[model samples]
Target: MRADSFFGKLTRTLTGDPGPTAPQSGGTRPKDLRRARLNDAVLAGESLVGALLTDAGMARANLSGADLTGADLSRARLPGANLARTTLVGARLVGADLKGAVLADAELTGAKLTGALLTNANLSDAELTDADLTEANLAGANLTSALLGRADLSGADLSDAYLTDGHLPNAKLRGVDLAGVNLTEAALVDADLTGASLTEANLGGADLTRADLSGADLTGAAVFEVRWTAGTRWPDREVEERLRALSQEVEPGVWTVVGDTGRSRGLRLGD
Candidate 1:
């Protein structure tokens, strides 16, 4: 049944059997769709730049506004994939599963995504500048308003991450490592963690106001209800007796954004 088959013309244009939503991609499919399954494939606004698609499954695929620049998509499964506004510049996505992937406003500059699972991933307003994400899990991920400049995110888990209104300053984590990161409720306002190591990190309710944690290595860090101030740079030793029963000194260097914190902290960034 070779009726112009590129997976039968994208499975008859995503199973309406009328075809041509935007399906005339260059040379018509088969860009080595390795281990291809393509469940629920729509391939919206398709371009698929530099496609290899190793281990492709593409679960719940819509591929909204797809470009996929420099795409490899290594180990691609793409669970619940929509890929809103997708470009994926310099994409590799090594060990990619992309659990609940939407990738809102995605660009993904210099993307690698070393061990990508991206649990509960949306990455709102995503850019991911110089992205590597070394040990990526991104547990309960939203990372609202994510830019992530020079992002390496060493040993990344990011447990309980919704990360609202993060205007992390100082060139956005220069020489970023983020050692042993959990960054719970991460919104390290004006973040500039000089010499960032952050060992054994949890950082519950993180909102490090004017944060600069110089020579940063909060040994066994928990920092419960952290909402720091006094231009926060608590260099070690003022873990402050583990933040003196939970650090709180808000309303200094004023940075506020109370806009629908994913329905007042019920944060759901993916489907």
Candidate 2:
């Protein structure tokens, strides 16, 4: 597909006209629209796969359910855009600004989003398996129930992010900041969290079976009802003592951490 075809579709969308029917696969590739001013464009549900929109200005655009798979949007300004349920698999979004964007349930498997600015973005239930999000600014992003299996999130800023019930098995999260994040009942089996910070984060009922926690800082973290297996690595002996003091063995090879508020709310491991 030629690059001009993508621009033609964009023109049609801007003029309030319907674009041509998208191909079955490998849609039109957009030309270099670097620093292109495209604010408030109505591009919802369009197929622009492999588009080159590097450093483009796309603030407040509506791209919900759009097929942007494999699109190159590096260093683009996309603040306040609506990309809910969009298919961005294998897309290159390095250093892109996506602040306040809505990406709930988006398919981003294997996408490269390194160094992207996603502050306050809503990405709840997004599929991010094998995605490279290293050093991405995801502060205050909503990631509830998101699938992050085998994703690389090293040096990412996830401060105050909502990650409740997320799947992160075998994820690489070295040196990541998760301060004040909610991770209730999240699955983190065999995940590598070396040097990660969970300060003041809520890990209630989270499964940490065989998860690596070497050099991690869990100071002031809420580990109530957290599940731990034999291979669950602790930061140190003192931290383990604190965890055991606030927990009780519900059954053999199963423990339940409880809060100090005299409440009976706790979850049994391996249940």
Candidate 3:
């Protein structure tokens, strides 16, 4: 479990050239793969079979299309890595550093990403259903069209994240900081947002049906075609009155409202 042994194995695996002292394939040898220091390891398109990478540093590594399913990468440093289309299902990445990484179309179902740093990461069209991202830093991340259904994002920092057309149904977002996030046309049905901050967030045409916003801050939020119920809260009384006055029930369980009082009428929801 020495830190240097893990890095040596990872280097040999990435380069596709086994070193002189490297262990043979399918051997019963116990390699020390814990706390590996593998900075800039090129593991793209490689198949990592149940590798132990706990507390490893693989920053700026090229892991595109790498198979990391069931890998133990907890507390790993993977900042600015290219992990596009990588298979990370059931992987443990708790407290990992993945800032500015390209994770587009990656499969991260049931992965533990708690307290991970994913700032400015490109996660567009990624499948992250049921992933645990609680308390993670996703500031300025590009998550457009990503499937994050039932993901745990409670207390996560998502400031200025691009979440346009993303699916987050029933996701836990309590106390999350979503300032200036672009959630246009996103689906957030039944999502929990108790005490979440959405100051100046662009939620135009987003679906928030049955979402809990008991103490959320939505000052200057764009609400064009946004759906909500009677349980949804407004930060101020004046804003609540404005919303009530502007909202008009157009159909059963559906309401309509005007955005900026333009010529066209927007949409909302009703209880």
lDDT of 3 by residue, 1-271 (tens): 3324544555567456566565556433343356766788777877664678888888898989988888888888888889999999998888888999999999999999999999999999999999999999999999999999999999899999999999999999999999999999999888888888888888887887777777888876777777666655555566667766766666675664554555323322221
- Superposition error at 231 for model 1 (Å): 18
TM-scores of the models, in the order given: 0.31, 0.86, 0.84
**By TM-score, is 2 or 3 better?**
2
| Model 1 steric clash total | 0
Task: List, residue by residue over 114-209, the lDDT tens digit for candidate 2.
Answer: 999999999999999999999999999999999999999999999999999999999999999998888899999999999999988888889988
What would the per-residue lDDT of candidate 1 be over residues 1-271, giving only the tens digit for each residue?
Answer: 2323544455444454664556466636445556667878887767777777888888889988888898898889988889988988988989899988899878888799888999888888788876887778877787777777557665666556655553334334533444445566676666666666665556656777777777766665555456666667766654533453333344554332222434423221111
For model 3, what is the alpha-carbon lDDT of residue 193?
A: 83
Worst 10 residues of 3 by lDDT: 262-271
Per-candidate local distance difference test: 0.67, 0.85, 0.82
lDDT of 3: 0.82
Candidate 1, superposed: residue stretches over 4 Å from native: 1-6, 10-32, 35-53, 56-84, 87-104, 107-114, 117-124, 127-134, 137-144, 147-154, 157-176, 179-206, 209-226, 229-237, 241-271
